[model samples]
Target: MNTLMVMGYGNSIAMSQILVVVVEILLLVKIGEPLECKRKEIVTNTPVISSNCYRECEYPSKPTVCEYEFNVVLHQTMSAHCGDCPFKKEDCNLEKCVPVDGSSRPLIAVNGSLPGPSIVVCEGDTIRVKVTNNLQSGAGVTMHWHGIHQTNTNWMDGVPRATQCAVARGSSFVYEFIAEPAGTHWWHSHAGYQRASGAFGPLIVRKSRKTEFNSNTYDFDLPEHTMTLTDWADMTSLDIALKVNIPALNPRSQTVTILMNGKGERIEFFDETGQIFKTPRQMFEVEAGKKYKIRLIGAFIAACMTSFHIEKHSMTIISTEGGEIIPYETDYLTIAQGERYDFVLHANAVPSAYCIYASGYGNSSCPSNATFILKYKSSPLNNPTCASYAVVPASQDRDQYMGNRSKGMFSAIDFVSSDPGDQELYRVDLRHYITLRSYAIYKHPKDPGYLNGFLAVDNVIYTPPLLPFVTNEPDDSDICQSTLNKTFYYTCGMKQCVCTNILKIKLGKVVEIVFLNTDEDIIQHPMHMHGGSFRLLGLGSFHTKKMTLDNVIQLDKEGGLLRNSPVKAALKDTVMVPSNGYAILRMKAENPGYWFFHCHTMNHGERGMVIVLQFGEPSEMPKPPLDFPRCEGWEPK
Candidate 1:
């Protein structure tokens, strides 16, 4: 009487005799009859190797998706110390890398190249790079497009924990974004410290030559002339980071060698065997009497301030960070990390090979130097006798470039922006002053042995959130708003203030961000802001012995602040804030999304020198894709 009905595909059983009926139904399905069901098949698109690798980018009449496949994996240099490079065997393995740096250290390569593959496209073209993390070591990776304005496609920015999660091992991620504001740019790893292990390359966004700002100044702009400057070491970035974080290790982790376009002679600093081998150098070919437009990218991971100069030639800088500037000639260029310069080199010297020199400049820098040959097309293949390292500049003073020692030296203030926006940043709606400093921060309040060096902005170490802010609205308990309750910069000094530093800016509001490098021990920091370029208002040291935010504010109110050319200030995304000095930047918060603002120096940035800039409201931001990879904090469940 207490019967229950159980439903099957085409039969029902009463609970009174359920056990007997279930056994009968199981026998019927397994032996007596076949169950009818519809099976589904799933198909996944196979990644294809595009044959357009390294081909010249065309300026398309209409925008199109420039898809690229990036297979990131652990690779090694060819043979021993790249001695067997330049192989021409038809059956030779293309996956083997040849850095030509005379070191067979392990590297993380993209598409089987040291500097990876260059992404050259026209402005407004959509770039879709499907990155497959092929590393068998169970590592994750992400690529950041340096100097790219993500605009409505903020998720494609490639900053893990800020924009999106890392592409996990054996997984793939498709980064799709529209390229705009054509200029010399680059792409590199934003995860796993893999960029220093040779995971970066040039990214040139081209527009019509006729529409270029300083087009008439140069006669030719070739793809081969684009050079990437980087610092290399025999050890991996993780080893260097370990030595740096734990200072008691007596860190000899400075630049062992510098590379130009992934070519350099090996330096045996860490090589205990002291084995040296001859390695080939990069050669830039030029025709006689032709003015060549050379695009230089400073992609260094170290804190080395590199100065580049070509012997018997002068460089006329026309543009910086993709913005056209008033042309100025200089004997050499002192470039920091994450900076780009487009200069015109007039091949006026006699038809012969000349040494292009690059040497480290400033204090706290090692004697890291590199050389490349600039040879005329018809010249013989001979090494120049004068192809030696140039003497490093003795003057460590950066601000002295404006005074008596300014000849043949040009900084950002020396050149003015030729074409600025219609709305000048004469005044701003909000102002935020941050002091760039490095000091010891103990992890625990009562523990002194747990102290580690941390680079901070306004005494707050920027720790990235586990869940990306772009997709998830993290609770206030997750982020550390140190400045909300603080008034002065030195209040939290030596107190270990670490958190996800967030700076919110309203839409269309012009904001002024002043960087104060009042800390005497700290050197120059190349501060790079994401999303868009800004107006470089000023850069100079304070007159007082001890300067603070309040002091700078009073100086600004009294018109005592040293400023650049107000009308022709340079437009830049990265500005070098001098040591014991200051830098002023102004821009309108138009891009409505979360962006990164941090020191481009990888060592400093990794040790908490960063800030998250949230522009506009959540409603104004573009929504991410439905199937986009989502990440969150995972507690011990």
Candidate 2:
């Protein structure tokens, strides 16, 4: 990586060089340009780490640009059962096979690696990623920077139909943006159900850990401590989504396993002499008595609420959604789709192997669990006796999987933001009440017979428009409603009404959105925003069974709403709205452009649980580049 060098800091430089620097500074000011980090390339094995990359967020004088070239390819798994290979092994040759767990299933890999590759850079550095689509299946793709706030570069938000069109098959798209508000983040496929097939990776914008608010909580923040958790199924994501959409399918969609760091399946290895070698599972080796910062990513495509914990160990969560929070100690974490958390794990337990477990809600079809080994440097290489991938006993099951398990489980309201400036979030200027429900899509618009059921936000199903939201001049027919209200807008109940649902907000308004999940089925929806994160002010269950949108508004006005201190409210880009409950989120409408606000579940989002959160007028937003590609639905005469 390129580092900006200066001859002197105070008086160590020659007079002629100092004069040249002064002249350059004056020239830069005259042109109204700010200094940028020079672009550099580094090759590495792990995602988000390079030996030549900047070590501290405060170093290099000026930011250094990070560049990555990714080729999205369709690949297949290599080994199964006892032949599964461990992650990042030197002898894990991929010349003929790609080992992703023990299942020889098809996957959409990036450069032939599951979980893609990592992108790491210091805050304020420019990130330029050139992605070439080589799926060979004639499928288009788009990559969404999960927690990156695309400030001025709204076109790079990567939401197909909202920010820009999908990079078509065999085509390429270069995404350029400046990384800001550094924290743990991730990236995944934004087109179709490709993320379920492993088109995702870690995206970390580093800041000096020593300068962070809770930096003192952890002793070491190493690059190898990143853990990405994903729900996996035997079938491809497209096929799973198809089964989910069909009501007659016995179990809709199935999540058979959960993968950590792209490694699942507790399989054993053996030598040619028939002697047992070692078990292949994602292992995090640590030293006893040391505190390590572990970045956890919830990259699951399914809607199951997965709980993560290391046996006989506790975690102190320091940050989430790229925003630091006051350290909150918890036994385990219930993570939702598209969420990121950084916690400090103290390795003070006995120097032996322990089970790093992940358990989903214990539903027969959609629920499953997986385990990895957390081994100490002095521990043996064998698997832990306590590391059982089988069903956990009720006494050992910490995730009490009852309906809306909010009584004992830690919720968003439990976290407190460390930033003192977040007090402005509580001063809401506008309030919006959105109710989650399901509507039927009929075979014919006028026919009573329905083909399938689709989820919706605020009673309106989102249909991608023929034109992108940023470039299109949408009229009455394109949008579901011109104006929304504090309560319900238009009710499409069981009728088929799908349109572009865009909610406009005035620039700089502090908005409060109350999301109510009134669906009869017990399910959690992780609601995520594209442009920026928000303050998760409150979360609570409804007290009355007959509560409606108007009732919720009146309850809030009557001081019946659940709210924490505004100065210490939790900041998150995605908040899981509990089943048959509610979540209150507050944020300042600072980012100017069209942004996507949607349910992060893959199938739900694919079937229209999305809306556009438009800030400022269309004329005030940034425009796409002159040569930017444009596309629309196919038209035939």
Best by lDDT: 1
- Model 2 segments more than 4 A misplaced: 1-54, 59-61, 79-97, 247-255, 266-279, 387-409, 440-450, 482-488, 543-546, 632-637
Candidate 1 lDDT by residue in tens digits, 572-591: 89988877788888888999
TM-scores for the candidates:
0.85, 0.84
Candidate lDDT (C-alpha), each: 0.76, 0.75
In model 1, which residue pairs have backbone atoms overlapping below 3 Å?
Answer: none
* Runs in model 1 lying further than 4 Å from the true structure: 1-61, 78-95, 248-255, 267-277, 387-391, 396-405, 442-451, 480-484, 488-490, 542-544, 565-567, 633-637
Alpha-carbon RMSD, candidate 1: 11.8
* Model 1 poorest 10 in a row by lDDT: 32-41
